[model samples]
Target chain A: SQTIHQWPATLVQPVGSPLSLECTVEGTSNPNLYWYRQAAGRGLQLLFYSIGIDQISSEVPQNLSASRPQDRQFILSSKKLLLSDSGFYLCAWSVQSYTEAFFGQGTRLTVV
Target chain B: TQLLEQSPQFLSIQEGENLTVYCNSSSVFSSLQWYRQEPGEGPVLLVTVVTGGEVKKLKRLTFQFGDARKDSSLHITAAQPGDTGLYLCAGKNGSSNTGKLIFGQGTTLQVKP
Candidate 1:
């Protein structure tokens, strides 16, 4: 069985601080990884997705960026955080671009 | 840009009642999926519809994909409090292989016991 591990279940940081969220997948190789953000209880906004190492596609222009250092390790980072950057971040992995994806426990980041 | 529009952003219903959630899009999709998310958790995939006009049932939940592959619907029979959660519709564009999935705004469903 494949499992995704995402960290810092909850985070509180002051404005202008840096952000680093990590996600890793086990039991799968060369899987498609994605990062998403959700505001309040609404839908998820695609942040970034990677097909392979060093191949990242960003959906929106924002303060955040993503990198896939290894086949199963993906990281989301920001040089400086904004108040609008506060939200629930999720990480997911799928076998194919059109297949069902498995998600990790999301991180709730509060920028004050 | 491809986008999906989900109807009834929020729904509150009584137990034992039936409800249907709809997701529509003008752009064609190769596949559509439905997911359920509880509070403080990530969305879980409930079902995936690949063929147009395809219907799949999981217990009390029935999902249907439009013949054009641009729309889908989810119907829940005998709603239970356990069914209270957020429902999301996601579409996979036929042309994109980057796996750039597009999501609907999502519908929040609350079933009161």
Candidate 2:
């Protein structure tokens, strides 16, 4: 079975600080990875998706960026955090296009 | 960009009651998925409907995809407290094969015990 692991299940950071969230998938190779953010009581918004290593497509433009350093490792980073960056960040993986996506436990980020 | 719209942003019902939530879109989708999300956790896939006019049942949940592949609905029979969560509908963009998904605003369902 494939599993996705996300670090720092919960994070609290001061404004203007740097943010780094990591997601790694085990038991799957060359899987499609995605980054999504969900606001309080709101639906998720896709931030970035990668098809392969070093290839990322961003859905929305904001203070965050994504990188696929390895086939199973994906990272979301921000040079400087903003108050609006506070939300629940989720990492998901899928075997192929138009398939069901499996998600990680997620990380709750609060930028104070 | 493809857009999915879900109705009844918030629903509160008692256990054993029946309720239905609708997801509609103007653009056709190659596939559609429904997810249930609990508080503090990621959304989990409940069901996926691929074919037009497809109907899938999972326990007490019945999901239907429109014949035109542009809409879908979820019907719960005799809902239980465990069914309370945020329901999200996502569609695979027809123009993209990279697995890009467009999500609806979501419907928050609360089944009181």
Report the lDDT tens digits of candidate 2 across residue range B1-113: 67899999999999999999999999999899999999999999999999999999999999999999999999999999999999999999777878878889999999999
Q: Which stretches of candidate 1 lie over 4 Å from their true place?
A: none
Q: How does the DockQ of candidate 1 come out?
A: 0.74
TM-score computed on alpha carbons, candidate 1 = 0.98
Grade the docking of candidate 2. Answer: medium
Question: Each candidate: how many clashes?
Answer: 0, 0
lDDT tens digits, residues A1-112, model 1?
Answer: 8899999899999999999999999998899999999998798999999999999998899999999999999999999999999999999998865568778899999999
Q: Which candidate number has the best DockQ? A: 2
lDDT of 1 at A87: 97
lDDT at residue B59 of model 2 (Cα atoms):
94
Full-model lDDT, candidate 2? 0.94
Which stretch of 10 consecutive residues in model 2 chain B shows the poorest summed lDDT? B93-102
In candidate 1, residue B72 scores what lDDT?
A: 99
